[model samples]
Target: MTQSDFDDGNEDDVPEWADRVMADVAREVRRRRKEMKWTAQKLADRCEEIGYPIPRNVIANMESGRRAVLPLVEVMVLAKALYTHPLRLIYPVGYVEEVQQLPLTYPVDTAKAMRWFAGLNENYQADHRMLHHHIAHASALERALFAVQGEERQRWAAERAIDDTARAKALRTQADFAERAARAKDELCQVRSAIAADGEPLPDLPDTLADVDPAEGYERDTD
Candidate 1:
């Protein structure tokens, strides 16, 4: 078997958990390939058509548990070629249920929140930072109100009270941007998910587009 390099550690010897995961992947790949009645070469050809080339022997080795590491990009391309979601390849059936059943420190939305942050514009991010800074200042001031003498505490509290109006205005603007960003992300996911479902039947054409080439326009009513 030809050697494959893994980023986790020594390329020659892989960890047990990774090996187990790869074993599951190997089994899933083999199962899906058989379900589609496709030869390894055919799968390879499809992958190449999509710009990721996987040779037949490599596919064989991967299925036979000879390959130590499957690159992430290859797994995604393989899932694309095999006509299924990448999650189905990496995780077992009922995996979503299993994950939801486990206790966690943070909400699952945290990952999506990070992605939303990453996609923010520089101006929007600056606004976000400024809002956060203002919030921190308000919070610190509010806390100091409890620790100070009578007038000093009142003064600290008054400062936060004075900023409340401006803070609310800034937050409203950020909220608008955040809502639009979320809607755009959801729309993007829906479209890409439709593309990933390559084996499924296409959606029916819209009423206006049914039965005619767009360039020719709708067939004129002919008696």
Candidate 2:
């Protein structure tokens, strides 16, 4: 028998199982790209810009199940570009089940997670503060521009009005941030309570954590 026939594993010459796996990978790549609102050409351009240099035709071939087995580095590049894990592309379905069955040897990073949460809380508070500042400035400008008359006056007044509107909108956004901060604080409290109930030392909340209290006259809701 010829080498091609021998490689095919039968006289009927069916595609190998490896081909199917590659096809699945390709399909997933295309599917994720589409989900991210990117076209094949757009994805190719992004890949090239990111130093991966995948051609449109190669992408098309892979999506169409004609190409098999991408390089490991290429798989990693693709996953980074797609904002997904490399294993999601490489492993077949149900592989995560196998991962879960493995023993957990590493300690969970509760401190890191709490730190991240606190950082987000601080960012939200900063946004709210900035928004409040803008609102105050806009309101002041609107008040200052009220006495002028003429086209120049009219223009300034209109601009101030727009700024005032923006300020109001910013206030609403600030309220949203406050609500989110409150929820995060509640979560932290719950976690602390759980730890206390277990007779463990109370984990200190991160210094980055924001103090969000509606009773302090910080508006919790704007509308």
The model with the greatest TM-score is 1
Per-candidate clash tally: 0, 0
Give a tens-digit lDDT track for model 2, residues 48-154.
88897888888887788667657778777788888887656644243212111112222123333333433444565356654434444344333323322232334
> What is the TM-score of candidate 1?
0.39
Query: Model 2 — TM-score against the truth?
Result: 0.36
lDDT of 1 by residue, 31-54 (tens): 899989999999999899989999
Model 2 Cα RMSD, 1 decimal? 16.8
lDDT against true structure, model 2: 0.51
In model 1, which runs have C-alpha deviations exceeding 4 angstroms?
1-14, 94-223
Clashing pairs in 1: none
Error of 1 at 176 (Å): 24
User: What's the C-alpha lDDT at position 134 in model 1?
Assistant: 43
